[model samples]
Target chain A: MADTTTGQSLGAERTTEIQDAYMAMTRTKRMYGGIMLIVFIALMVSGFMLADSRNAGGFWDGILNIFNFPGEVLKEAGEKITLLPALMVKFFPSLVETINIAAASTLIGGLLAIVLSLLSTRGLARFPRLIGVFRRLMDILRAIPEIVVALVLIFVLGGGPVPAMIAIALHTAGALGKLFSEINENASLKPLEGLESTGATWSQRMLLGVVPQVAPNWLSYALLRFEINIRASAILGFVGSGGIGYDLKNAFSWGQGRYDEVAAIFILLFLTIVFFDQLSSHYRNKLVGKA
Target chain B: MTATAETLPITDLKQSATALIGRKRLLAFATPVVIAAYFVYLFFAFDIPGLVDRARMDNAAILVADSYSYKTHVTHDNRGGGLGFAIEGENKGTYPEGMLPEFVTRTGEDAVDIALKAGESATIEGSTLRYTRPDYGTVTVAVEGRDIILDTPDGTVPDWISASGARVNITGAGGRAVVTRARTEVYRYSMGWELFWFTLDSPFYGKSFGELAGLAFSGERVVADKSNLAAMVHDFWNNAMWRHKDVIWAIFETVLMAFLGTMGAALIALPLAFLAARNFTRLMSVRFAVRRFFDFVRGVDGLIWTIILSRAFGPGPMTGALAILITDSGSFGKMFSEALENVDDKQIEGVTSTGAKPLQRYRFGVIPQVTPVFLSQILYYLESNTRSATVIGAITGGGIGLLLTQAIITQKDWEEVSYYIVLVILMVIAMDWFSGWLRGKLIGRSE
Candidate 1:
């Protein structure tokens, strides 16, 4: 009976602490919480209405047909072959081409970004206004989807992989430029200052001091973006840009009984992503000297 | 590498000028070259016009009219030989020539049983056989040209008759010919157990991914090449009907959907974040729980959230929106909470100590301090979500990406496909600007 009473007292004490904390809250906080709650409720309700997941099968099936159409074309190609061997085949040729295009864009974009970062960072601290502009520009660049960019460009440049690659590369440059600049800015400033004190030129100082510090981070970021590029390539493939995404789309679009094949390709893609992640993590750890 | 004043100060100055000239040369030559090179490559990388010609010749026009005349191809998945009759010419699709013919085909074959019309040729073989005009539906000859226009029963439309029957040979542009035969092929097989992941990661990878794949799977195809893959790309670039347009639409719609959805996520996240911050809230426990919940939502990827939304709503803008909302909830929640927590408490005290009501105190003290950060984070996410929207669209089948995939597979029109790719990148840029403007308005109060 005494133990039970003690337990009850402990529970009571806990409640008292909670209430004390609650009571201790300044009126400013309660008011904020109440208002925030109301806003939260409204958003949640509206979002529920907007994103409700009750009727998505038809849409999914429709898209599945589009993305996996390449697979369907290949299968319907009437190449008599062993089932197991065919199942293990990788991306259709066109999809592979898409990946190539996306990769090319990434390379071109990253290369350009290196230069942009140099200019942006050099001007950023000296002119705080430039920082705002640079930052805003990047935000704007990233806000628009690549697909939309492709559509507009299609009207201008005609349809093909070149416009797609240009769009992908441009966005890549924008994104990478910002990330590289941040790394440079966050890098150790002591070396650059030391070089400056030695009467080293600005370019010399940046090359000898700044570049070394940020190189590892840049490489890490680059590697990460490569993975993203692959996914982006798949996206481009959907738009007839060329790649395996179309194959996946075809596989999904045909009929209901072929989900197993769709699942297989999906698995391969997932595995590819996982493998890249593992490889990247390995390199990142080695670079950082993680034990 | 060193120039000295002893020889001549003027000379030294000139030498230094030369060094500057070298640097300028490096910048002037490289900068424009790089940008110009990119533009050049974007303009004439491969035969962009050839893709159009090919598409025009052997049209695989989408089923925009619910029915199409498909010239069967005998080519393998690699545009090689398959079992079906390769349409000898552009007698495959349902489009009119010089007027968007209801059907058009390049080299694929048709096996339709048709009643011969007077002075018309039945597209059966490779040569346009001469026929005498007998009557409205009497005389007929099978012709094999780059295109074969057949007079079907439905107002003399172009239709392929080899549904599961005879095969046709194609001879044109050598590689552009498609084989026509009844096809029951399924996509090439991929190893299973690769996609069963339940973790969060945004790490990078090196080229050693193959070693890992080989390790993970027992029966791995080392060389997955042209046979199954190439045909897909070719179809996507060259096919018009539904291939290019559909994927483009998917991508376009995805961008719009994501932009709208991110807006919703931010609207929900901002004020709640302030409340969730202990420094800004009256209830500590509520703040902690709400913050944790937000974290949980943010913990999952937008793709997973897409699946969840698909379950909640039919696949459309709703599913895509839900996915964006769930992912952005966590992002906005954390950003807003941090902004709220960082606000100067002195201001809050200044307002409240004067016996001001809770609402007035919050309005005067807290909102202003955090609005800038809130707006900036929202903008950044809006930009980021544009890319993320691609994935959401993929999950829901409501974006240009859907058509994009089809185009890549069926038409192989790489040039047109490139345009879609460009569109997405541009959209990301536009979002970046709008968000920045919003941030400036809320905080910097600058132009």
Candidate 2:
């Protein structure tokens, strides 16, 4: 009876020690969390103040006038509602050019991405030693913003769809290459090993064995990239190239008198973006779901 | 199924199998053919053949060469009767009085001798400029009256030398010389960026790295009020030609735009996502309305948002940030709702069983369950928004993109353009690494 009582007391003492340690750890964690939250809030507040100071119009002032431009646009566009169709129709070719830029770049970039991803994949690379080189190349390609390339190319090639296409394509290749390589890593190596045993070349193995397994995922990613590239192409056009975005820019800068044209371009752009977003998402869901 | 197939005709199965294979094979062949045909159509549509005609090879050459090298102008005004030395013919890069490039020597009161690479020499005497090529002998150009005259060693201008009545231009491998009625100029091409560290006015300009290091620690003051290192840094930061301070500020503003936009979007979208999530909200109308709002904002796209916001906020990083915030809130709303819907109801039920209130239950159950997903999405967007911020900055007129556009617009600032490109790339890579690190720290690496 005496020994049992002593053992119970000892166990209680140990429990108390553990509870104290747990409380200390929890306190430290809470302190860290609080500190982090304070830091984050401070950063956000200061950043806002800095941005506000640098802005040509202060946030409070701008917020009140936020709806002014849109209201004017809508009113003017409403006044010329009958001309909306003609305006959209007139800009349709430019819209098509924008789509073409996106599509062609996606096609070209997707193809290049396939080759790059294949070459960079560990077990599937033709020259395994050069995988790092290919990866770094993709990183660089990805790091460069499309606008930089488009602007530079505009200097060389003059303003057109070609520069925009090339710029978007280069970016797409880098982006898709990274995603595709990730997909490649998850693929079963058994197929590759079997193909190797069958005396298949690297290209043949990749095409016959790996491509079959990853094609759907790759296609889905490419489709998503295509959606992104469409927006990118339009933006590039607005910057200097040729497309609906260029038309939008012209209409937008023309100000009040051309608000109808601006609204028409806006509608066209919005519709196209929505259409592609839905279509690509639908296809992507199917592809990923089937897989 | 095999038994039924066996009960059926074997030839019928074989025919069906053959047809299936044929169709698959045809699809395999047709896909590439269709792609090729589309490309061919695109070639015509994009005017690929005419692109060659439209392409300016000379401009390309100038861009490539000018990006890596700079030329020093040794100019003499015929009427003004004075020699001036400037880098790239820019007023800011003008050499101080009594100062000249190391390769230039004052031969007379109004003349100088320029020694170029490979035993090439040019001497300016009064209004005449004489350029001596190693093997081709000396070519002289003199501005006499309104008409400029060129005299080659052989008394005939070669293909490289283009002489008109009003001007004479002699292009040589070493340098280029042009004689006009108003002035005569000689351009000496050299490798590397000039005045990159310090402008022409700085006392520390043209100091070697070792010499700079020595001076930095030697207790010597380049300027009266500051130490050598401080003075050096001040000069480098305030470099007029490169504008390093402005460039750095631009980069900081870009990152600020991205950070503010991404975090602000996440903050705005969180509550809306709960309304849209099927598991969280009971009313269908609320969910539908929230979801449609998300779609509308997303479908309007960043370009449209940038345009509208710029009009309201004017040209600055604030506009770019707001544009990013508006566009990404839509994306975050959709993604967060999906994530919220995927959360396990058991956790919420467990919290409620503990006699927790609705807010307490959500805090304990829902937030924890979706925090990881929300964090991952926000971090991913943070990195991407940096790139978008650059593009938006271009449209909104702020950040490094604005600087880049301005530089490019100048057409002569290719070197600055190249510098900005490098810095932009580095900034992006740094952001990528940082976001990745933060993601790993917060949620652990998914891969």
Which candidate ranks first by lDDT, i.e. highest?
2
Model 1, span B316-432: residue lDDT tens: 665676578777887788877777767898999999999989789888888777766666776777767767776566556666555444444444333334455556556556565
**What lDDT tens digits, residue by residue, belong to model 1 across residues A1-291?**
999999999999999999888877866677876887898577656544443343354434544444344354346443433443356365444544565666678778787777667667753244555766766666555545566455445544455676577778777888898889877777778887788899988768767787767777887777777767766666555554555555555655555555445545554555555566567768887876777
Q: Where is the poorest 10-residue window by lDDT in model 2 chain B?
A: B142-151
The lDDT for every candidate, in the order shown, is 0.55, 0.93
Q: Quick one: best DockQ, which candidate?
A: 2
lDDT of 2 by residue, B169-287 (tens): 88889888888888999999999988999999999888899999999999767799898888989999999999999999999999999999999999999999999999889999999
Measured against the true structure, the TM-scores of the candidates, in listed sequence, are 0.45, 0.98
Candidate 2 displacement at residue B112 in angstroms: 0.6
